[model samples]
Target: MNVTGDDVRSLALSLPETTEQFAWGMPIFKVSGKLFLTLPEGETSMAVRCPILDRDELVLAEPAKFWIAAHEAGNAWVRVYLSALDDREELTAIVTDSWRQAAPRALLDSP
Candidate 1:
């Protein structure tokens, strides 16, 4: 199944303390006021917080699915093509991972 921006939004909002806001004329998801994900203007791809160290590897390993916007090159974020996603499960994993990165420690420790 194809993963769309709506799927990304739903998965993102499902995470604890996640909220949607608009910025740069695009939808952005935040956890406890910390940005974790963003759906750029086209909604065809999403930018998610990623460890700077892992970003290069992900992009190099799967250029079709992952990439770093030139504007975000020095930041710890990577853009993921929604159309390239394999399934909802994969989307969940990706969205949740980003949420975890931005989620507060208390939220992370919660059962």
Candidate 2:
């Protein structure tokens, strides 16, 4: 619900071993040095790690909520429209899932 880049940043940093770094002129969140999410230039949307298969299905299922930037095509990432999120729960789940994907196995094993 009206998720902003700050919402994204706070959530991402709340996860274990996550850090914020700037790359390609945007903010990127990484887990143990592995990139997990990115807040593009306008911060209207965020890109998160997603299996290519799942990304395609998501984009097709909810084009307004999810998409793959042309430059990001062929990569295992999907962009979520912050404005399109249904609620904070959805945002948390999405961000956490991306964190899980990039987090070290040791971190995943912990609570």
lDDT of 1: 0.92
How many angstroms is residue 89 displaced in model 2 relative to the true structure, after the best TM-score fit?
A: 0.5
Tens-digit lDDT track of model 1 for 1-111: 688899898888888888999999999999999999999958999999899989999999999999999999999999999999998888888889888888899999999
Per-candidate TM vs. native?
Answer: 0.96, 0.97
* Candidate 2 Cα outliers beyond 4 Å, as residue runs: none
TM-score of 2: 0.97
Candidate 2 per-residue lDDT, tens place, 6-109, comes to 99999999988999999999999999999999999589999999999999999999999999999989899999999999999999999999999988999899
Question: Candidate 1, 41: how far from true, in Å?
Answer: 3.7
State which candidate has the highest lDDT.
2
Model 2 per-residue lDDT at 81: 95
Local accuracy by lDDT, each model: 0.92, 0.94
